[model samples]
Target: MEAVALHISNGVLNGPVSAIYGVIALVALAYCVSRGRRDLDDRLAPMAGLVAAFIFAVQMLNFPVLPGVSGHLLGGAMAALLVGPWVGALCVSVVLIVQALVFADGGVTALGANVANMALLGTAVAYLLIALLLRVLPRTPTGLGITAFVSSVFAVLAASQGFVLQYALGGTTDLEHYSLGAIAGLMAGTHLLIGIGEGLIAAVTVVTVARTRPDLVYALRGLKRPQPATAQGVAA
Candidate 1:
């Protein structure tokens, strides 16, 4: 069986660290449920469902980056861009929970760490990055696409850093075999390539949705209306 390094394995994190992450993840999930309830109206139901399903499927297909390392779509950033941040976090959390419980894709005990890194950090960072980018960039489809691409990379990179932090604290993995610096370096570096793939996929998806169903794109919702045509142009 090929070993995967991204998801923290069971017993890799000590009880204290795991408990801490569990508490944090639970708090975030509660908040997400509260927020998602309001956001998941009939209008958003189909889009949200589709986005969650797509993310789940994409995450299953991992691309190899190195000898033992592989990376998959985190999907938090893309979900946030499509839905709102809170609901986006919730969407990814659902996938992580199901993957952990049903598929045993991630460590059962490490569910909290996985959710915290992939769902909370990814969605929150992506939301902040998008907001910051939108202030400077024009509010057009092209501009939104650029924002999605950049945010996706940054969000996944941020999540990768979160993993490094977890590994630094009470991690039972090859920490004794390898230095913290080495672990951080490898995690961040590989995720950089993963982020590139994430950015491209997110950008293309956002552009396609903007072109086809602009109304469903939450990121582009508040764009300013174009100026009205002058009387001469209207007459002509």
Candidate 2:
């Protein structure tokens, strides 16, 4: 996903587009931390924090997806699937900040757009789509497997749409000249395939946690049990 480039490849601050999202991410992070959920079990906090850190490190891994386009797992869906949406978004925003401030991975000013595209939109959309798909899916392992498989692209592209909009707004390029539809479609489409990896990781992670660390499932709230079928779909 092009959004992955924001974190993996350098030059986040070199451009204005990235800097905006980076800033937005920081602001949103502060808000989430201040108003974040208090019901988060103590045991899960450390896991979630470590998970966020892992996602940050993963972003550093620049995998060449195409000739010029490189990508990395945003991990928003993973975080969301592990925890809840707001919490997951918070996790991603924190990682983005750490990347920009400590590792110099993303741009400082562009944090806003990055937050919008990668953390907020990506996590929220993925969580929603996964939940929806799960609700309608056969409720069998095969169905859940397929749900997990396709869930990534929804969030990936939703986040990509955030990028397309950001690019259109202050992209410093002619929207028409760039062929927004073709690019967005292609980017989202490619990410659809790439997201399969993310989907598998999410599905397996959920299943593993459900089996081993059911207690660690941050999304399990009030239920006292995290139905192995629904690991973390805002179940809280």
How high a TM-score does candidate 1 get?
0.89
Per-prediction TM-score: 0.89, 0.75
Q: What's the lDDT of the predicted structure labeled candidate 2?
A: 0.66
Best candidate, lDDT: 1
Clashes of each: 0, 19
After superposition, the stretches of candidate 1 with alpha carbons farther than 4 Å from their true spots are 1-6, 66-68, 222-236
Deviation of model 2 at 67, angstroms: 5.3
Clashing pairs in 1: none
User: Candidates' lDDT values, in order?
Assistant: 0.83, 0.66
- Among all windows of 10 consecutive residues in model 2, the one with the lowest summed lDDT is 4-13
**CA error at residue 220 for candidate 1, angstroms:** 1.1
lDDT of 2 at 5: 34
Tell me the spans in candidate 2 whose CA falls farther than 4 Å from its real position: 1-5, 8-27, 62-69, 137-147, 175-177, 220-236
